[model samples]
Target chain A: MSDIKARVSFLGKSANILIWLLLIGACAFVVTPLLFMFSASFMPAIDIMKLPYPWVSDHIHRQNYWNGLRGPDGSFVFLRNTLNSLIVALAVTITTVLLSSLSGYGLAKFRFKGRNAVFMLIMATMMIPFETIMIPLYMVSMKMGLQDSYAGLIVPFLTNAFGVFLMRQFLLTFPDEVLDAARIDGASEPRIFTHIVLPNSGPAIATLAILTFRSQWDNLLWPLLVVQSDEMKTIPLYITKFMAETHSDEGIMMAVAAMASLPMFILFFTMSKYFISTEGLHSTIKG
Target chain B: MQYNKRFSMEQKKAVWGWIFVAPSLLFFLVFSFYPIFNAIYMSFFKKNLLSLKPPEFVGWGNYVYLFHSKTFWQSVSNTAVFTIGTFIPLVVFSLMLAVFIVSRPRFQKFFQMALYSPAALSSVVAALIWLLIFDPRGLANQTLNTLMRTSGVNYHWLSSSSMLRLSTIIVYFWKYVGYFTVVFVAGIGGIPDYLHEAALIDGADSWKDFWHITFPLLKPTTLLVSVMVMIQCLKTFSTQYLFSTSGAPTRPIDVITLSIYNTAIKDHNIGRASAMSVLLFLVMLILTWLQLRIAKTEDVTYN
Candidate 1:
């Protein structure tokens, strides 16, 4: 009996070791491409393309960065593309925070007719794919004279359903007595929101800001449809060559990709906890 | 008199609610609801893009043309194949990965952070990484050749039909498989520890315990992850769009999003694109409805 018990313990230990090995192996698999891209961005054009697989550059070369920024034919500037993206992302984030918090506060605090219907409508919008609405939104932008302008790129996405949903779900748990106390002290609703509610909802606001910024920063499709000029082109457009004048060179591709992804890596690494927090995210449909 | 005082307070509350919600409602009306309705309306007309001519009324003509068009059919089939191929393996592997992370408590955060690092990458960047791996004599092929002890395997990752499809699937899976893993881990983490202890006390082994306790309890997370993954896969455009334009065969990778993009922007056909959008809209509506229905029937298993 003692011998059998000892054998079982040995088996359990081996299984534990195997699980750890598998876990590390999967982590490497997940992280390798990003690391490879970062490393490959430093490699020269010849080393990037030639065989024997240069995993690391023999000598660091920064020309790829210059080549990428100089555009494919050396006829354009990549800074403009990045600037366009930054402007759109920042606009969307600030607007989303303001609009979503106000509306989410309304949905959570007020006892009003049609409140349920309004909330349901906003939640339902999350399910609708953008492809369904692209053409009509495109037409609307053109008719409103927003095409090829910053307004066209940023206006449609300024406020999103997900932000409202996130904000509302979070504010639902907020104490009602605090607002009542503010009201009794003669604070108006807007004043109450600006002073009392906004200060308390810091975590939700941060979550929304990070999420909004990350998504808008990575936005591709809508911008692809609206922008027409070389000056208005975004990062994905450069790599995909939708607005560019020449095909992407192999080294330039790595460089542009690395540049495009750097801001997000910083954001995700710093806000890793918020990005994967599962409370309001996974349990959206609460019982 | 008493009724008047109570009713006035309720009215004041109602007015305040509308005041706060007005901006968001107006934004949605113009951007979300109105555009959806307009997309439906535009599907029935023949509107020439880049022309001042008024749209001609041709009810079902665009839809009919789409039904007969070989390119549209190919795109629909490609989308279906991409959705099914990518989603199943992704959902299963991510769930297993989540379970593994949950079992090992010591390095849970470490593995979670490592696995989820790729979720932040844009699809364009994700595809660019794989583009290297799929090159003729690139590292992926080289590694496989070395493993099999063969030289110059010469598989066409981008050029061939089947291989091109597989390459796109790999790119997507690499980017998002970690994301869903984190979601599942969160779901599994929410399960209380007492149940596992009870199972162990009742002589249940690790595999049997997971099958009985963890898997059943994860229904909500599984539903949420599957729905999100399905919609995301259906709406995938960047990888497919970037792949074809960057020299892969456009036909095999022509997803519906890419098709809509080309029709509207490239060929200047708004009506045809609107027709396709309406169909996609209907499909998403059904998927979402299915998720809601399934979620409602589960009846709060934990409580």
Candidate 2:
């Protein structure tokens, strides 16, 4: 009986240790790729492919960043792509935040015929995949002579259904009497919206802005189709093309890839609280 | 007299409503609603993109051709395989991870951040990073060799068919599991604590409490995650696209989206591609409806 007790105690301790080890291991597995990309970016070109896995680039070469910034055929073209991504993402974020808040406030506070139907219209189309619409969107853009332009790139995705839904739900939580009081004080609807609602809805606006910016920043297939010229390519397009062009220079390619991921790192770290759970984005829809 | 004045005020509010929703509504109408009908119209014709002549109306010819095409069927099967492989693991493991993370309150944010960061990466970069990992002399092979203690474990991830399918699934799994896990954590968090406390009072163990209370309560979330995973798996492209273009065997990794892309963009067969899109959309629509119906029936049985 004493031997049995001793065995059980040892087993319990081992199990506890094992569970902790597994948790840490799982976390490490989740993060390995980004770490590898960051480390390999700093590795020497020759050492990138060396055996035993250069997990953390022993001989760090800071010049890899410079080499990667150099586009195919010695043109500083990659810079243009990075700039294009930033411009599109920022534009989409600002437009989405403004439009969604106004529309959300209108639907929540103002009584109108067809409001529910309009909201339903947006919700029903929410799950429609972009692939189904890309071809026709491309065709329409071409017909309108908007292809390969910044307008084509940013216009279609300026606002989404989820944005409207999120803003409406958040604004619904705020008491409505504040706006009515503003109206009694001789303030116009637009003035009340701009001053009262917008100022109060900071967290919700940040949520929409972060989600919109992240999705736009990471957009690829649409950008690939819309922008044909190297001058107009976004970061994903430029890097993919650059990678295919210079397949041999991997250290440099990794460096470029790392640089491309900088916005994601920045956006994620800054807005991480908003992103910690889908509760921020999900629960509002049903509510 | 008072009633008439109130009616006028209601009319004014309606006008303001229109003003507020106008811009976003206009954007959606042109971009979303217009394309939906346009794609349907294009699917009936032999619309070759490079040709100047107007599309020749083929009616259901593109659909018939797709039905007879062997490669189309292959792509359907490939998508199914990838969906099943990735979907099950993602749903199961994300749920488990969510449950585990919730148990450890102190490290929830740590694990959450580590997992969620990958979701922020562009598919292009994520695929590139994985491409490096799966290289012949990369960490993946090195670890495999060391563990097996044998020198002859070459899986030929890019060249072989089964291996290529598995590789794409792995790429997607690594990218999205954390995202869905965070969603599940939020879902689980919403469950009232009293149910678990009651189970404990009744002498139910943790496992029993989870199975009886937590799992059943998380039905809506599980459904959402399952549906999302299914749709995303079906629509997968960038990684598969990069793989084929980067010299991997294209046939093995030819997902439906890739085929649609090849037909429309590369082959310039807009009619065929549009038809494929319509069919894929129908599949998605029907699958979602079926799942909802199944859930409804289950609720009847259980409740």
Measured against the true two-chain complex, the DockQ scores of the candidates, in the order shown, are 0.45, 0.40
Evaluate residue B194 in candidate 2 and report its C-alpha lDDT on the 0 to 100 scale.
Answer: 63
Give model 2's docking category. Answer: acceptable
Summarize candidate 2's per-residue lDDT along A1-287 as a digit string, tens digits. 01211111213456557656766877787798888898889988678788876677667788889988876577878898899999999998998899888888887878888889878777555545688888888887888888888998988888888788888978888887887789779887899889999999988888788778877887888888889899899998887787688878778888999999998888788778877754431632321
lDDT tens string, model 2, B59-169?
999999999999999999999999999999999988878776676666778888988789989889998888888887677777678888977477687778998899999
Which sections of candidate 1 miss by over 4 Å?
A: A1-14, A72-76, A242-248, A279-287, B1-7, B294-301
Interface RMSD (Å), every candidate: 5.7, 6.9
Candidate 1: lDDT of A20?
77
Write one digit per residue (lDDT tens) for candidate 1, span B122-215. Answer: 7777887888878886777887788899888877899999999988998889888777887787777666666766776787777777778879
- Scored against the true structure, residue B22 in model 1 reaches a CA lDDT of 86
Cα lDDT of model 1 by residue, A41-133, tens digit: 788767877676878878887887887788765765578888888888899899999999999999998989899999988877866667799
